[model samples]
Target: MNSVFIRKALLLSAVLFSSVVLSQTQDEVKKENPTVDFALEGRIGVAVGDKAVGINVGGPSLKLKLNGFKIGVGAFPSLLVLDGDAAPRLSVSPIIEYKKWMLITPYYGYDAEKKMIWTFGIGYKFK
Candidate 1:
């Protein structure tokens, strides 16, 4: 069990570090072509479902803005704190953002127990 946790922690760290590097590269590309609109932002929010309510953290979203619409996908690591037993999970969801408000639907989450769950969430994004 300890080994599993350590592995997960390491994997998460690598993902986050890679995302930051990717975001920086995108910024440089955007500077060269002003027509391309790309953004990376942090998100934090709460999710609730019939079985559980959880807090979402480390939600790094890569977004594209066209006209007035923003669309993206985010990977959220969450803690299901209100469930029968607290569990850590990762959720990947399609995201739509207007201003700072974010809507996440069909949030597909995979937990340590290898259970898959679908839920919906609302969140705020930080610029």
Candidate 2:
């Protein structure tokens, strides 16, 4: 009876090991699949020292393969609030992204007064 129990334990161990190895092999193959593509990223970054709140919205932006690139527009409005009146200060930035992550854009933005400003930044893929 003891010998039978030992044999059963060994068989179970062998089966578990085989399953793990097979899974690893399959994962490697999937990684090398050329047809497989992924593009989806979302990040929250801050710009300090400007004393202004920055909001960036960029994601699944797509690479040059699709539409040559994607667009990323950001806005920063003044944070002043007073007696049913708010000072409006809006800034717009249009960015071009590559591979749905690498954001390489030179924007012609404007403030509430329509003043022009330049903005540039880089991004990373997270998917």
Candidate 3:
């Protein structure tokens, strides 16, 4: 299964398990509902490797919360003005978040030379 599907399955399992473990009676179980969270933020980071040093730029990021689950999308661009000889770079990341503001984001990127790229990052929400 794709990452998205796997994440959804895990979230479903977690909610079901929590309901079972926390429920003391039928009434309490029926009252439990997942809460949603929403946020707008910016991210800054860099891509570094041998031969060239790349700078990271800050970009808009979004998060949507449902129950204890969150789904998010972010886009980042590298201006390349500092490193003209380096590879071209652009990136997009779709992410999933869980309880306590923990986030997992797997990213795809491209260089100016059209090489395959990948990245993974973990984040936390403070607000």
- In terms of TM-score, the best-performing candidate is 1
lDDT of each: 0.62, 0.39, 0.47
Say which candidate scores most in lDDT.
Answer: 1
Query: Looking at candidate 1, what is the lDDT of residue 61?
Result: 70
True-structure lDDT of candidate 2: 0.39
Q: State which candidate, 1 or 3, has the greater TM-score.
A: 1
Per-residue C-alpha lDDT of model 3 across residues 12-110, encoded as one tens digit per residue? 545654554345342433334658656655444443232233444444668798886767776656533223464445556565555433333333444
Question: Global CA lDDT of candidate 1, please?
Answer: 0.62
Candidate closer to the true structure by TM-score (higher is better), 1 or 2:
1
Candidate 2 lDDT over 1-127, as tens digits, reads: 1445445544553454345434543232336657868765464322211112333344333223456455555443322222233344343444444442433232334445554333334434355
Q: What lDDT score is found at residue 21 in candidate 3? A: 39
Candidate structures ordered by lDDT, highest first: 1, 3, 2
Question: Which residue pairs show collisions in model 1?
Answer: none
Q: State every prediction's TM-score relative to the real structure.
A: 0.55, 0.31, 0.38
Ten contiguous residues with the weakest lDDT in model 1: 21-30
Model 1: per-residue lDDT, tens digit, 15-93? 5434543454323222565886667767786655546566786566788997645788878888775348887777787
The lDDT, on a scale of 0 to 1, for candidate 3 is: 0.47
- Check candidate 2 and list the clashing pairs: 63-99
